[model samples]
Target: MTMEVQFEKSFYPISSWNQGSQPYLASILFCQGRRTTSLSDIDLFAHFCAAAVPNLAMVESVDDEKIANRLDRVVASIGRKPLRVLVQVNTSGEESKSGVDPSGCVELAKHVKLGCPNLEFSGLMTIGMLDYTSTPENFKTLSRCRTEVCQALGITEEQCELSMGMSADFELAIEMGSTNVRIGSTIFGPREYPKKEAN
Candidate 1:
């Protein structure tokens, strides 16, 4: 199974400054995939606010209202509105990728807009197959999903940010209209994982 990790928690230990103290650029806290029992939605949202990081919580099979209600409470707590959010879509139809199916993206977006007033409903994001280079088909799938999501939400494509690319094929992704690309490894080099010890 694809591990569902908090973006901030993974990076916080190594960073020099606090979450919101970055002088030059802003950061986003992406909590992708399912919500575990240990971390409730309220806790996650509070962390997002406390860290002052924009959140992109990728919803899988969870009920939309549950997400909306949690967001509402978060807004109340922060006394702020319009939190940036992304609806992750499984454009590749890969079981390994963590996101809602393409068919369900529009409905989820709609729910986020109509049901979750606190969320800004920024756009859509997806993680394609790692082995495969970003292909035209993959781009097309995301484009279609974005179009549908915008239409369902009565918004335009320009308003929806398409975050679909990584260091591997960001060039093609840019040509295909990816507003955001994840290029950490390309700039920082490959991450070193700790080796396992024998039991």
Candidate 2:
């Protein structure tokens, strides 16, 4: 099976790609569509690729050429099949977010398109500011990146998905043309972050 998950209209993706997520993939595959963003663990990336779900996932935290190139090599060695990827854009301009800046987005996307043969330059994704709803500015920034990438790559806007929004702002995101939204929390409840230990 190819990494065939498509971020089609109203795509609802689960947000869990940790080591513990493997067993659940069997059941999750029954959904019409599924995706996992915030895939930040570079080390686990190769491990997942070599596992069972490699053909059913997309990496969304790819901000630089280094990470994209690394994925290319990993996929090349694993099965030489094309893996889908979304160029993460730091539209909020927050230092803590893991994504490419608005200015360099097109350049990085170009690398993914022409440079990474084992990868499919699928679309663009972003995390809005944690404290706020999906701001039009953030949506606009990602939309602009998508437009630029489509124009530069000779692809249509529809072909380049805009994976913005979450459960909190999915309606607004869909209104603003977000093809994909992460809504796992809405179904499963808020995440339980581990408590920090005292020093």
Candidate 3:
């Protein structure tokens, strides 16, 4: 398609490589946004478990211990194939946000790490100010959460990821220490290109 998809991180969404991840599913390939209003979380997990190609890797919005325990139980029921999870943080302190308060991130990370053997505490994520440009402080807040999550769990920062950023401000997010980003529409959707010369 001659489109440019740019980013520097462990995960990259390149337009040229669209629909090319199926071959690499055996590796730890995480698909975000499994939750929907129509289906409960457990129901969604069940479907993923029952899928012919069940590569349900990481979930981004685990905000509390209750959810962590519930998901842990589900993962246990399906043998030892563990689910990687990210503890969502409400960095901007928005009342409308779905994640746990930033103050509670460590406790949640600990619960997911020590209490839930069936689930891996992959990292932290946040949906900062709903705009084209997110506040840099929001990114810093997530990085701080990562610091706390790592210290409390005795794990290195690399072990705990920071999944913050989307298409618009992903570069800035990365500059502020975002490891993973969600860039779906920017990659799969239309792109602007210069017109070709007349033949």
Candidate 4:
């Protein structure tokens, strides 16, 4: 199997390619909803081509405080140069969820842009709280949250990228003005269950 296929098999969706010692491109390779593991170095920039290929990367399970901390680190390491950073906010009102309060993300964005002049504050990314059955309330909550976050960051609606839909709610998200929709099950079919550990 090709490296791309191997990546797909091991991580399901996250894709990265390295040609020789140069990094080619890095896009969001995989997403496991709200709670997800952080990407590896290869996933971040090992084989990335920022100019040729879109090196899209996202923060896993983001919160205002965490965003602030990460922004500080990025600024320190990369210095004050505009860097594209996609902030993923998980807006599930459950303890098991992986994001911060939607409104709170605005504060995080502001801090990144103002405090970390190096980061361009590209847009907002989010996964709706998982619900067995879809509801208007679910979409409504995500829509409202997106709007609030954009407002907090003082970003124009056109500039704000709303990433709040997946295979289950892609249509809903599009209808609700989702800029990016992550499709998984639709393209790959249902996933197999991994072995579970006993308590």
Candidate 3 lDDT over residue span 1-199, tens digit each: 1112232223454333322111111111223443435223222221121111223555667888888888888878878588888888888888988788999999889888899998888888887898644468899889988888888999988777777766667666666666665554444444447999999
Candidate 4 lDDT, tens digit per residue, 47-66? 11111122223332334655
List pairs with backbone clashes in candidate 1.
none
* Model 1 score (lDDT): 0.58
lDDT of 2 by residue, 164-194 (tens): 7666776667667776666546544576789
Q: Worst 10-residue stretch by lDDT in candidate 4?
A: 46-55
Candidate 3 local distance difference test against the native: 0.65
**Best model number under TM-score:** 2
TM-score of 4: 0.59
Instruction: Kindly report which residue pairs in candidate 2 clash with one another.
Output: 3-55
Model 3 TM-score, all chains together:
0.68
Each model's lDDT: 0.58, 0.66, 0.65, 0.50
Regions of candidate 2 where Cα sits further than 4 Å from its true position: 1-56, 197-199
User: What TM-score does candidate 2 reach?
Assistant: 0.72
Candidate 3 wrongly placed segments (more than 4 Å): 1-55, 132-134, 190-199
TM-scores, one per candidate: 0.66, 0.72, 0.68, 0.59
Shift in Å, residue 180, candidate 2: 0.5
User: Per-residue alpha-carbon lDDT of model 1 for 1-199, expressed as tens digits?
Assistant: 1111233225433233222221111113233544546434423321121112334333222224456567656765777656766677777777876677887888888887887777777777777777765466777898999888888878878788776666576556665776655544543457678999999
Candidate 4: clashing pairs of residues: 13-29, 14-29, 14-30, 15-29, 23-47, 23-48, 24-47, 24-49, 90-99
The numbered model that scores best in lDDT is 2
Query: Residue 182 in candidate 2 has what lDDT?
Result: 61
